[model samples]
Target chain A: MDIAIIFDNIGIYLEGLQTTAWLVSLSLLLGLVLAIPLAVLRTAKSYAVQAPIRAYIYFFRGTPLLVQMFIVYYGFGQFEVIKTSFVWPLFREAWFCALFTFTLNTGAYTTEILRGAIEATPHGEIEAAKAAGMSRLLMLRRIVLPSAFRRALPQYSNEIIFMLHGSSLASVITLVDITGAARIINSRFYSPYEAFLTAAVFYMTLTFMIVFLVKQLEKRWFAHLQPQKTS
Target chain B: MINLHGYGPSILEGTFLTIAVSLAALALSMLLGILGALGKLSGSLSLRLAAQTYTTIIRGIPDLVLMLLVFFGGQVFINQVAPLLGYEDYIDINPFIAGVSTIGFIFGAYMTETFRGAILAVPRGQIEAAYAYGMRRDQMFRRILMPQMIRHAIPGFGNNWLVLVKTTALVSIIGLDDMVRKASLAAGATRLPFTFYLVVAFNYLVITSISVYLLRWLETRYSAGVIRA
Candidate 1:
């Protein structure tokens, strides 16, 4: 039990923790940004407009992230044209490759969640907004998106936690995140238990915090949905 | 440009291993699911706490971390125990067992929630009716509860199984010769990661789509009695 090594190496682990946080935050922000338009396209009335987005979502959601990462990192490198393209700079680095894959993967799941929330928005609300002479864009900005966001908060939080968990896969692609750090330390010390247990503890604490915050948000947003206590 | 001319045999072998791993893990997950669900629903406080703790901890941790921990830590633990138990040779855990057990352990947490929810959704009236007819507890569970719970659980179980199938890809990191690992090797050897991974993705889609249809058929069969004439 190399317990002392873990305790003394808190500073080293903190750097890994910071990398993990950055990876999760960047991927989630990008994923959410990409998801909105995709979700809107999914709900579009025309089959021609909807088909590509549907395929994107199905491909991303259907496959594992590890495979996706390998394809993006190694697959793109196989193309001489891609290497010479303007986009090669972004795809050249492991971190960017990871970020790109995570964003796309979470984008698929988030699109589904946001689409469900948007569709679930009451028809009456939109009718009222239109009757009030609101423009289509204004109606979307003022009425549709706000309500959809509120409705989607709980499930979106689950997506966030899942993305955080999924980001651990990036370690396999050579990104030095939390799991990667554990692997490096485990190799150095030949002590898998201590290194992995520390990483597990870090993940659990983050998950607990996310769940707690999401619960608080749910209470604030859905207070009206709670049943009244009888005297 | 990408080519996949020479990767057929290796990819096929890997696909077989992936299927075997997924099926083994699925079986183990179902067993754990039933047991964990029963533990949560049991009268004993200790059993309930144990189940809750297992699910919560597994759910909270990342699957990759858990997989690595179990794979490497398991080897270490086994070697230590082997020496203590009078075994002289250091026994290494096989990658397949490690992969399946890790996936099973992680997904067993998910399956517990799915199965437990399905069980609770079974009506109280049905159980009471069974009791009224003087059915023993075992008889009631086997004949009355299990069948109905499976009916309600098939959809959720199907989703979990699909995800588990995809998750077998993670075992590749631990040197398992599953499809993803084989694809990785093929990509390295052939310099055609794109073609091979796209093939792998399509393969997953085919399997998941077939299973989705099968689950739908099972759902329809189970609900036949309740369908309106």
Candidate 2:
């Protein structure tokens, strides 16, 4: 139980932490940017618009993120056309591949989460906005999206934690994330418990912080939804 | 470009293995889930705390880390312990057992939450009515609790099963030679990573599609008497 090994390679762990942070935040940011529109379109009255979005979400949510990562990292390399294309440079890097996979995976899940919240938005709220002569776009911007986002906040927070954990797969593709760092330490020093358990501690700490932040956001944003105090 | 070139059969075999591993893990997790839900609901303070800690820690950590820890670290622990019991060799933890148990243990936390919520969802009035009928514990559980709980639980259970089936792909990381791993082996041999991975992904799609329908039917069947909003 040489506890010094973890502290010995503190810089490597920090680099891994940076990679993990970069992957999770970028992917989550891109995922939300894409998911909001897809979710809105997913609830459209027309079948033509809804069907393709549904398929995209289903395909992504149905498969494992690891397999999706492989498809981007290794599978894309199999094609000569892709290698010759301008995107070849992006596909060649493991970080880009990982970011692409996580972004799409998280997007698929967030679409569903947001879609559920949007559909559950009180009909009376939308009705009152319509009766007030608000335009469709204005009503969506003011009444629908805001409330839907608040409702989706709790579940979406869990999704962020999940993305944080799933970013560990970046290690598999040689991206040197936190889990990747642990793998390096394990192979070098023959200490799985210390290597992986230390990584687990970092991850658990991140999870707690994310949960706390989400809770606070909910507290401030959701005050009106709470029961009112009587005088 | 689209051909498996003799690796097709092996990939199919791996697909079967993947399904077997998922089912085995599902069984183990459900057993652990029931016990965990019971522990959480138990009157004993220690039992509730133990169950609470287990769920929190397991849920907090990533599945990959736990898989690696249980497989590699567990192997090291067993190797150290076995020599004291007169075993002379390094114990190679079977990846199949490692994968199933790791996924089982990880998903058991999820199932615990699902089961606990389901158990709580069963209205108290129904239980009181069962008691008023002078039914025994087993009779009450079978007739009243289990059926109603199943109704509340099916959707969550279905979601977990879908995720569990996908999680089977992670078994390949531990060298379980499941479908995803078989695809990898084929890709390595033929230099056609795209086709092999696409095949496995399609296989997953088919499995999940069928599962969605079957689980939907189960939900409908169980909700025969359930009045819906």
Name the best candidate (by lDDT): 2
lDDT score at residue A127, model 1, on the 0-100 scale:
98
Clashing pairs in 2: none
Task: List, residue by residue over A39-155, the lDDT tens digit for candidate 1.
Answer: 877888999989999999889988889888888998898899999999999998999999999999999999999999989989999999999999978988899988899889989
Q: Write down the lDDT of every candidate, Cα atoms only.
A: 0.91, 0.93
The number of the candidate with the highest DockQ is 1
Instruction: Write candidate 2's Cα lDDT for A94-166 as tens digits.
Output: 9999999999999999999999999999989999999999998999999999999999998999899999989
Cα-based lDDT at residue A174, candidate 1: 85
List, in order, the clash count of every candidate structure.
0, 0
Candidate 2 lDDT tens digits, B1-229 = 5578999899999999999999999999999898899899989999999999999999788899999999889988899999999999877999999999999998898999999999999999999999999999889989999989998899999999999999899899999989999999999999999889999999999999999999999999999987879
- Global fold similarity of model 2 (TM-score): 0.96
Q: Model 1: which docking level applies? A: high
- How accurate locally is residue A211 in candidate 1, as Cα lDDT from 0 to 100? 92
Candidate 1 lDDT over residue span B1-229, tens digit each: 4357778888889988999999999999999999999999999999999999999999899999999999999999999999888999978889999999999988899899999999999999999999999999999999999988988898899999999999999999999999998898888887788889988887888888888899999999887777576
